[model samples]
Target: MQRIGSLPSDDSSPGWFHTSRLRQPRPPLIGDAQAPWVVIGGGFTGLAAARQLALNFPNDTVILVEAQQVGFGTSGRNAGFLIDVPHDIGAPDYIGDQANAKNILALNQRGQHILRDLVEQHNIVDAQLRHSGKYQAAIEDKGIAVLNAYRGGLEKLGEKVQLIEGDELKEHIGTSFYRKALFTPGTMLVQPSALVKGLADSLPENVKLYEDTPITAVDYGQKTTLHHPTGRIIADKLILANNAFGQYFGFLQGRMLPIFTYGSLTRPLTAAEQASIGGKDFWGVIPADPFGSTLRRTHDNRILVRNSFSFNPDGRHKPGYTDKVRQSHRLSFERRFPTLTNVEFEHTWGGGLAMTRNGQGFFGQLRENVYGALGCNGLGTVRGTATGTLLANMLAGKNESLTEFLLAAPKPNWNPPEPALSIGVNFTLRTGQARAGLEA
Candidate 1:
């Protein structure tokens, strides 16, 4: 029933938007279920963990529960940038210590490799795998200095990054506003919904997935029970991959905040219009806007413009998602590329990224043996993928080096206690939007 809005179970995993690939039929549900481990959330991280568990430890039972269909949240709604290193949109949020930092880098690079491998191994038809790198473009005067400073972080990671200036910037992204830029080649782009469906299809047969089943309650301890309106899943162990929605679990809610982001694709440009913008090769661009606008080109020549606005663009929320936010990405895109304003908004959607106060992601065991991973902070393709792998390893048995480092605090510290939760998120969002409105 949810169409052209934020992803949610049964709500809007949607039949709309630029072609989201078809997915496998939802698995039959079981009442009072039981499994060795239950992953609550059918998005990327949950599925990734389930797939790995079935492959590596086939004997162990894994059950994935989603409120709606697979790839129902950020995983399905992402702009499909399977990126690698050097882009610090949200990496700093997950790496709290030296060990955490190294793990973050290693796993992200691993995610890049993993994404390609999945397409090949599974023969995912919808996977239009292309190795299109990402370009960072500067708009205002201060943007150049900000990018130069960012280059330092890229260098510290020892990952390869190419900076674009003058002619090259014009060559890649013709906008004159771009004074400086950065490029990383390993970033692959795909149709997010299709990629998600492909991943779901590849999930192990033994690992059951239930759609249209919203988890209403969590009963913790050795045999944690995940309760739904019509059924329940009782598992020996549990892994929380619910992201911003994990707050209902009580232990995870305030640790990280939920940041909302949106994206829109223009109706395919005609030959002349496409040429006017620049070459088709300049597909990906993200200007460091105060609210963060991301741009990309679709396979069929549509231009995808995106941005996220939280209750407070820079503040907090119960780590989760909402579909009701008023869309401003298309409006902002019109301002950035006025000539293209007439191009209709082919799609308008938003997703929430789990975020921490210090910009570090939270990982590790939530309770005794129950492991958890969330807080991609808008860089999920790489960060979420990597964290999923680490969580799997940690849950498997003895802690891997990466798992040991991240276990320091599996969730972010609680949210501020001043106003009510809902009130707080909206207050910040209203304030941020007010400021942006004034500046505009």
Candidate 2:
């Protein structure tokens, strides 16, 4: 029996979740329940896994359990860029080896298409899923060098990219802070909370979703039994899609690192404020430096600033952490839109990213009938979806090619325990942030 060390909980002010049109969450699991297939976590990966399992095995009941309400966890707290290309934030240039990069692009593009179709089919207008593309902007010469290197990688992949700079770049993003930018039309922007909620609500009939039910313990055997507060669940097979939390289940322990990143969203800009910025109504910018800030102008006239990373080994933030990060966000926001000094952030929150020492994600059978799709590094939105879907397909004996590809993907490297690990990670993060300079 593996005891879950901790449950997922977020700060009170998740910008995306609070702003989204959220329905009442489903009731928690109560009493005893049994299912042929069970998936833990309500985030993108678990939702995708459960949905696919239902589609693949329509006759079998699939149960999905969430520790919190849908759209209120890490999945909903991202910067909302569904990148379709190789976006390895851990890599120096945000791209890997050419062949590996190509494979990643193919998988991520497939994930994007799957999500796009779901958004359209469900008419999830609130999700604001748009092919608006994204800008990779650089604020310093070093940052620009990184962007140029990234551009070269994209060119090698035969991907289309446009370089925007000076007045033209300002015309599009309303930010003179960036010296130059590379725009790629393939990335999709979304209201992440709405998209995840929509996916949950549109899950297949055979899949049962239970929100606000945190599993307390798990006994893994031929039949897996999960214990929650008020009830227990037994399943013939299990898929762990909980990402960083997978460590608590004794699955990815000593391998996955739970890194938390923060985001702040300003209250909607008034007409005057919008005109003052003088750019496209909705545009998203990813920093050229991996540790730099991410800025987005929402369709509804709000701005989002996301930056700062902390190595939270226990999978939770310390007291007052979000407040401190909000200050950093304010600086980033003011640096970009100096005219919007009066526009205050309405919400600030932190979200966890499951990273690995070797910059790889886990996807395969863990032990016996237990399988997992964990560690999305920093590109969880697309990578999580792709791996989760592939995990389901693999279980159902479908999409063998993609399944084999995922199986062949490298596993996360092991890490030293506790104090030593935390010290090293913190030093690395601080150094990266310091190097980011004005980009942060």
Top model by lDDT, which number?
Answer: 2
Candidate 1 per-residue C-alpha lDDT over 334-429 given as tens digits, one digit per residue, 9 for 90 to 100: 665677767887556666677666556667766765777777767777667767877787666746665665676344666776467658777766
- Candidate 1 — which residues are off by over 4 angstroms? 1-18, 28-30, 86-101, 312-327, 408-411, 420-440
Q: Summing lDDT over every window of 10 consecutive residues in candidate 1, give the lowest-scoring window.
A: 1-10
| Alpha-carbon TM-score of each model against the true structure | 0.84, 0.98
lDDT of 2 by residue, 1-440 (tens): 77899889788788899899958888998889999999999998999899999999999999999998999999999999999978665566567677788888888988898899999999999999989999999979988888888888788789999999999999999878888999999999999999999999999999999999999999988899999999789999999999999999888789999999999999999998888888898899998888899999997889999999998888886669998998999999999988889999999999888999998889999999899999979898988888889899999988666677888977899998778999999999999998899999
Error of 2 at 142 (Å): 0.6
Per-model C-alpha RMSD: 5.1, 1.1
Question: Candidate 1: lDDT of 185?
Answer: 75
